[model samples]
Target: MSSTNRRDFLRASAAAALSAAVPADLFAQSETAQSSPGAIWDSGSVRHLLPTVSDSRMLIKVSFTAPVEGEPRLHVGDLTVRGSMGDTRGEHWHFYATDLGPGRRYPLSLVGSNGRALCQPWELATFPGPDERPNRFRLLIYTCGGGHEVHKFLPTAVRNRLLRRGLSFQPDAMIANGDHVYWDLLAPVGSRLLGAAPEAVKAAGTFDRSAIVLGSDNETVLKRAAGPQIVPVYGTDFRSTPVFFLQDDHDYFDNDEATDEVVTFPPSYFMLQLARATQGIYYPEFLPDSARPLGLPWSSGRDRAWGVSESFGTLRFGRLAEILLYDVRRTQTMAGPSAVYIDPAVEKWLKARTAATEVAHVVHVPSNPPGWTAGKWGEWYPDVLGREGKLTTNEPKPYWQPGWLKQHDRLIEAMAAVKGRAPLVISGDLHAIAIGRMLRSGRLDLKDNPVNVVLSGPLGSRPGPLGWPSGRRGTGAMPSAHLDMEEQVKPIEQHGFTVADFTREKIVLRLFKWDIKTQPVEAIDTLQPFHTAELTRPA
Candidate 1:
């Protein structure tokens, strides 16, 4: 054979041998992997791994130890779906896959540029389709889950152990009602009192508008501020469970306080920017629901296109129940009589959902609670802490808006009007585990159809001394003067969560709690719920 023909034949033979040695799928994956430096993977490199799944879709948020060099890929079943960088910084990436089968558990894994698995494979199941009715559904609910770096009020070990105990129940899903990040820039405990390391403590001083968040020098400070609060506490514990994270006042880096100098809520432009950046990196946004209509206020282009929402969300578990989740802090306004904690459009959507009969049960999960108040400025009632340290409406709260109370009345009335199923509201923000039935609000009387409210306790906060670090409200959560409530389980200050079991007949709520000083460390492993409240369908 000629020299040229011999070289061609050798090249073809080498190519054929290489293809035979590699698996067909891996070879195909390598072809699509980005032609750039990529993220290095070890079992510990992924600092945070969380996924949120809908009936036919799943969105996974993966945060690496360092900025990723190229796009990551998710391998599920027979598909190799490409992922996009999810944050301004390169550390966080997202993998969104659609066309998944409803109610089916699919094993998923991440692959690098070399076509090798980055970590062990895990299984995630999609929710049952809207029309399909599963026998039972269970949800794990909690709030104020963020902890400071300096204080051991809620040590990392205790927080993880408590969550592990709750996970032992094998809940179908989890809802972190609000206040997921507690780095309150204005609070003394968050500012000067935290026990963080010297250098680390220095970085938490003040917000720097000079540097862009997640993509600039602020990235280091942001990580130092939020990383320990979230990463170590959750780790990979929630890798398999779908988590619905709702943001509140603290998530925006401020407390819901109104002082002569400033009103911390109605988040400022910078606070909003930081909140968005934090969420984009640490967790997944709410999956889109077709029932939630279009043209909702502040609907970003990406949010509208993907049908995902940043503030409003829905947890539709077959036809057994439909839970509407809304963040009260994000879009709150201060237009006096025109003021609203939620947009008028969102309020309309909420009322419509409350009145719907297709679902056996309808529940409202708001970032703010209604039945009780801690005498805070941002509340449904204009109650303030009396000189004696108790919530009293004798003196109107300073800077409190009247519209908030009006909107609260409208929502309660809507829930009361529902037929067949009992009206229920499960809320977070108040650091207590309590259940009450609101028979009246302002002039509106929900006498015949009382609104059931549940404060699904705090997971990471402690009721300790130095109330600021402990996150214990000054007056605790108490029934406001205008509210006529039947307090089933009065507000109890402790670190805990609620487990709710939903069926067509009724809903059962179990409250589990533990005190850092009282409960032995080992006792956490076998901790059982302390209170149980059952609400049945209307006769």
Candidate 2:
């Protein structure tokens, strides 16, 4: 059968199933009806759920504690769609509905084969159509949400409290920039903080490195290591909100380090598989974009079918704003002169999006932060730690590739070239809250139209012994070499997140901070933005 015919047949079958599964009285209600507040919620079978939405698609991942007895379907008012089982162990289920109405709210529930509700009925709204413009769009943005095993620096309870506070503002969506999990199997400092016995760590390293994560012994080990970091903190609190999760160095089960004995970047095949498995089980893949080709890096033929890119994604809010999301760690290469922190294809796509005027505002959300470097081997700049733990370019940074800097300059130039819009970049990896502009990069000068960057605050970092790895690198984020720039909000090591509001006239950012040492735990409930900056659209 042709593709058109296949789609028609499936649609008819779904309608028939919906007629049979849904009650006659319930089917009378409109698909866009409001969610029932007093609906029965089943927290036993469905432990948790997270959803991702686009202009016309909604993808939800549900976790079950026990095996599902029969086929489960997602009931969205009068419409019912079948759920696809995920993972070999049968705990994860994915319900994907496409060709949904744009900018419409859908109240949905999951019903089992026996016609019992599996989860609470929740509401999710799709994005506006491509040509349409929204008056306002709000996002809850944060980074470094993961924590060390034994470290209580921003424990799960505290993280949830912060997230609930952010939710109170009722953000349209959430962007978890990077470092969602922190169980580094390698790297010296991280390994010691694994909070596991030395023997157990050794066993995990050997077994996980040799096994495929999907069906083999590695899946359980991967779950044991990653589940605690993600499931507990996020839980079902985000059931009504769409989340975009970007992976960084720690998400690959190690830090980006290059020492004499081992180089931890350009993730090994096992590391890549483990990362894939973790995302496959926990989160939703990025929805498809017509502008982004499937041949891009970290994409497979199977991924092409789903139209999802694991490393590159787009969060478009109507014609008002388009935020490009890219993972700078997974596809990075270290081939000397050609080494790149992001795939060249991704760079090309980013440049094209940056230059496009389809959206009133264009923002870049990379897992790797620009503007400041911590004198690390994986950073774009070649700066190294000087005396008194200051960053300086005089000392050569070992294992630092020059190609990374070249690519960074090209991207900066592309963002600056855009007319009538601020070249805004929000990222999180540096573990600090900072706002700056790249006035000059190497020989390229962005002084006329500087590229603005914001280091979205870390959500789970602390100071002293329980702080982020950067706490050991230096005092905080510092200006790297070869760049002339001005720091508006100088880097401050604090635990917080950024709330950004995108509008046609301007983009407003409210940066919130909470110091675990200086502030009381209850202060998190009423934390306010310490600073607010507005970038008005160019005339």
Candidate 3:
């Protein structure tokens, strides 16, 4: 059958299954009625499941009702954490539990308004410290472009490949860097989308729309199921793997671009809120109970008016190395139509954290180097401010504005000051794979300073057949780029993820790619290694 026909058939099959699973009473209720408190109790898909921090913590967030109102009480096995209810743009309930540990698992259930079981119990687990005997941590990162659509075959293909590779190949977490769903199809001209829309509108417009556009026939069934099923299936593929989700531009709107007047949108924000409520894989639930309430203090009148304080945080693997995850996108400041600046607070945080830790490695998600370039940082070029309080318009046109340059300089200097501490950067915005070294002086001097930047593309998303032509190192149709290196790291069109194995001797990073299919395909393609060299700090 043609690809379109095959997709249609699959959608029909999924729709039938969803219809059978949903209780008839649910179909009869008005959209508002279905969202009312106690209404979710009737949902087979809706469960009072909370993503736990670790094996010891009792605190958990219960997700069931739509736009979860005032905090609810949570009981996990023998433990309990009283939830402090807040809303992410008055859309979904934001819950928090301050006390929790690392490396543990717990079973959690919810207590309804009447103190009875409202839904089935679910389990959550915490990440282990860096030193904890090298437990396998599977992280799946993917990117979304305007043309790309989520396909059942994509997920199915990923599951099959991992299955063939065995449990060892299963991922511990998943990151949807951005564009989790396409919203340009839903928007008309320039009116912004807010996250605080009624739950029904969100379901019909965003979730259901994405389902149809993505060709998921079970979209309605998945939508009616109450909680999201995609992440659960991926998690279930393994014996309950924890997921860490990150949103990119697509998740918020058609692209990451937002006017200074309006910051957040409804579709992306609503999707995020729902992801949190349902423990969807697209949203990171494995973060410590401490990381709950993840958003900025800013109060813009936008649906997804929430932002992570500083996307940069340290995850210590015992005493091995501190994993610094930076949210480069959120810290940017836009002024007029000319430049963007990184908030001073984030800059201070990055500098201070790097200086304080003796970590052997530093990992950045958006690994594009400082200075502007095409497709990557150039899109936001006007926002980058210069040191002299103006925009930089030097020849070759910097990829970023002045403000961005300052922030980039601060990060690079801080990392360099670490005195030979090997920094490994992993990025996924580009939908292609490559490996290169980051240098302070644009020169490829290995001795002075060296940082490994790995650009790994989509895990399962369809990246059309067109590939970048050879010799066109940094600029091309493919979504991959890296700092100038001795040997140019060319972009490779493939569908898969990258695995970084850090040992005492050296860090081994591997790229794994496969075709989309239910059955496993043999012969996975692997990439060559790029070693990290030792650097010397100035006295």
lDDT of 2 by residue, 1-539 (tens): 58565434323321111111123133134434432221233343676688888998888888887778778899765778887776777788888788888888777777788776665456677888888978888888999988744455468778877787677555788999888877777776666665254644553433447656778877777766777677767777777778898899888878888888888888988778877877788888788877787778766437322777788888988899898999989888888888898887889889988889889998999998889887878888888887757778888777889888888888988998986888899998888898988888888878788888999988877556446445567545677777887999988888888888877999988888888778887777676778989889889
Ranking by lDDT: 2, 1, 3
lDDT of 3 at 161: 45
Error of 1 at 116 (Å): 1.4
Task: Show where candidate 3 strays beyond 4 Å.
Answer: 1-74, 82-97, 107-124, 128-176, 185-239, 256-313, 335-341, 367-400, 439-446, 463-483, 487-489, 516-539
Candidate 2 versus truth, CA RMSD in Å, comes to 8.6
Give the alpha carbon lDDT tens digit for every residue of 1-539 in model 1.
58565434322311110111122132123223331111221233577788888888888888888776666788876778887776666787888888888877777777666654555566677888888888788888998888764655487767777777776666778999887776666543343444233544575644586667766767767777777788777777777778899989888887787878667879988788778877777887888776787567555447222666788888888888888999998889988877999999999999998988888888999999989888878888888887877778787688899899889999998898875878999999888889999999888888888999999988887446544222445666789888899999999887889988888999988888887678786776666778888899988
Q: Residue pairs in steric clash, candidate 1?
A: 150-195
Over 4 Å off in model 2, which ranges? Answer: 1-44, 195-206, 300-305
Sort by TM-score, top down from the best = 2, 1, 3
Q: Give the better candidate number (1 or 3) by TM-score.
A: 1
- Model 3, position 409: C-alpha lDDT score: 46
Q: Would you give me the overall lDDT of model 1?
A: 0.76
When summed lDDT is taken over every stretch of 10 residues in candidate 1, the lowest stretch is 13-22
